[model samples]
Target: MPLHDFRSDTVTLPSPAMMAAIAAARLGDAARGDDPTVADLERCAREITGKDDALFVPSGTMANLAALLAHDCRGGEVIVEEAAHLYNSEGGGLSVVAGAVARPVKGRHGILAPASIEAAIRGSANPAVAPTRLVCLENTHNAAGGTVMPVETMAAIHDVARRAGIPVHLDGARLFNAAAHLEVPIGALCRPVDSLWFALCKGLGGPVGAILAGDAAFMRKARRAVRMLGGGMRQAGLIAAPALVALDDPYPAHRRDHALARRLACGLAAIDARLVDADRVQTNIVNCHVDDADDIARDLGARDVLTLSRGKNRIRFVTHSQVDEASVDAAVDALADILATRPNWSTPCRESLPT
Candidate 1:
């Protein structure tokens, strides 16, 4: 009667070690920059990302928004991949909060090509157009089944941005997942961008927190943005302590999460090829394309298998530190049972956004 939860890594509960760290952490006013534990966490983040400084924030959305604000991107244009979570899911914070417009360029599986970004640039020659201020990217891109952008491609984009005198901000929500998949150091993956933010919650097993990292000057501005966005915290050591523990040894668990995703993908592909492409699953997420996502999700839930139906014909299954091989197998078995009953559920149809 155990539930196999494949909804998202955000659903993961904190571990015993993280809980213990939280209870034993020292406290101070983090908003005023006096919390020792918060400082420790910030130092750790900076070291990990090879940035000159880092600021801890409450969520990935806030960290990204702060990055934009710190870069003074208001009334400017930010080039982002069309399927990026920042453009589609971040509640339009880019436009509403920063007064910056998003120029969405289509890239293959959430990886933006440097040429595509170069073509999307605007306002440099003409004062009438919004000047391109920042370039945003996502690694282990969510909407594209957790595909990891190559480090080489990152460098190429950075080169193009440098020539254009524009800064780049990376939405590295599942950064560790990308690092583990590529077998590269976190710092190397981050060196090409001006600023980037990574969540301590997803896959890292922290209760909550994200870190925005950049140069000291940019961080000073980002700190102001943090306060303006109501993200200043007192005694935030409670959050930082657990994040520290999670960061200590994160990659191995992320590697296992990637393996679990592949396992789920292979199982789904075996059951029905149209349901998934195992090769496209690069990290912890398995984004399946099935016409009967809603009915399938409901039936699987009834059988104690929880899932997320992202759009009308899409289901997203994310593996995390808490999910095991048994959970993956159980989810596959439940889906198999559901598909057995409805043979024509995978019929070919035109894909449309979720309504």
Candidate 2:
């Protein structure tokens, strides 16, 4: 049987419409700001995010790095969640590439509280320590089972950052997912931050690209930083074209993904109540507890169902735009079958049990 790939949204390929958009793209050098399709996409992004400007980068990672480089100019420190993609998933780009230190603070789930920000700031200060110049946040935080950070929490952190005279950058790779889940406008989820990055390649389902949106001056500097990092592409309209479609297509892809997640989560809970917490199944990500996650993955791989271990014993199933209801049901049935017959799958999951 074919694999029901729920490993990550990045595994999704562009739809047929997206492929058509890519083929029909009007191209020009993006470095010289002449790429018509790219320029159109940027304009749409700026309008959508209610920002003065937006720069299209190759990936969400680049967009986050660009925002950080533009905002944290003074050899400073960045405050981030202990489990943030920027802190845990970005390969230490803040320290290695931006030459800044990440001051990570433990937070509830993946959402950072205002007090944590204030405390982290206070702890990082002194003449001997790097100045805390930026606060980074993630919405639909990946490491925390795609948890959505509430708008109030974001406003509180923004208030704290404002009082400290620091800029806030939101790593909103899944910002649209959060907006869809909260039934709010995407702008409402983004307006409080000094800068924000959103992905075209995630649930939006574009082939490759992300947008970094902010004020005019911020984007001007960020464009330079993107170039310095060798992310400046020529005729990038090829990718931007599909990204534009992904942004404009009036599809409830995220809601569909979330619905499938609910289905999968519910089905998993039915089989093993102690395994996956259906209540924690938010957005499109589900973290299921099982003993020996790698062993489970290997066993599932034999039947061609891809999964990722969140830890030693926690396997993550991420629904995406490409995963339909049939696929979700098939994956769930496969897991149930695995549990019914396999020795390892039948073993009790003490370490992997969801809290």
Candidate 3:
């Protein structure tokens, strides 16, 4: 049997069409802005993100770091969700590289409350306190089971930031997944933020790269940050070409991934409803609360059903372009079989699961 890898959408291999685009792509020095394919990709990114300009970067981490550095030049504070990828995953790049302090606030399913954001903003009168220079929001929040922050919620946060004269940056690594779930144009979701970045590798199926989009002024500063961080790539058309293909028509594949996630969630719920909330299985991430998650992940891996352990009792399964409905079903069956063989395994009470 073929292995079903549900560890992450980032594991997806480039499609045949993407390979063809890469082979036919025109190349030049990206640093000198002569790369035609990179230029096309940047223009396409701006159009999709509804931004005045866009810059291609090596990874999602760099894309977000560059945006943070551009928004907060001096030592200041950035308000972000406590469990956001920037705060929990990015290895302190915002604080160390950008010289910005992170002020984390709790959110409901990764959706920041407007009041919480307003309260976190520091008053300019207090010279001793670090001024809040930026507000960061993540779409399809990874740690929160790929929950999508609604456009209205984003607009509310934008309103708060605008009134405070602070710029808002979106860590939109899975922006397309969120858009696919909402069945809206990608621009509609991007309209509220001053700047945003999305990964081409995750879900989009590109081998590497991410795009940061904003106004030309912001991008000008961001380009400086990119260079400062050693992200200047030459002859980048090889990667940019495939990224362009991923961006052109990502919705169909993303929608299929979401459907498969729902299938996986349903299958798991059948085995044990307490394992996951099927209703919350939105986009391509299915987070389950399992007993001894680490052990279960190990057993599943041995069975050729790869998964990721998020915490003591939490496991994350992500569906991507490479995984189909059959793969999802096989994974579910394998998991069910593994759990059955464990005598100590017992479904937890529904109330014990996180809301």
Q: Give the alpha-carbon lDDT of every model.
A: 0.89, 0.85, 0.90
Alpha-carbon shift of residue 287 in model 1 (angstroms): 0.7
Off by over 4 Å in 1: 348-355
Q: Which consecutive 10 residues in model 3 have the weakest lDDT in total? A: 346-355
The lDDT leader among the candidates is: 3
User: Candidate 2: where is the Cα deviation over 4 Å?
Assistant: 123-125, 342-355
Clashes of 2: 0
lDDT of 1 by residue, 199-313 (tens): 9999898988899999889888999999999999999999899999999978888988999999999999999987887888889999877776787789889988888998778
TM-score of each: 0.97, 0.94, 0.97
TM-score quality measure for candidate 2: 0.94
Candidate scoring better on lDDT of 1 and 3: 3
- Model 2, 1-355: lDDT tens digits are 6678989998998889989999999999998999999999999998889999998899888988888888864478899988888988889898888888889887776878899899888434477888888999999888878889999999999999999888899999999889989888888988889999899988898889899999888888899999998888999999999999988842488898899999999988998886677898789999887867887777777777888877777888999976778888887887888878864454445543423
**Residue 306 in candidate 1, Cα distance off native in Å:** 1.2
Task: Say which prediction, candidate 1 or candidate 2, comes out ahead on lDDT.
Answer: 1
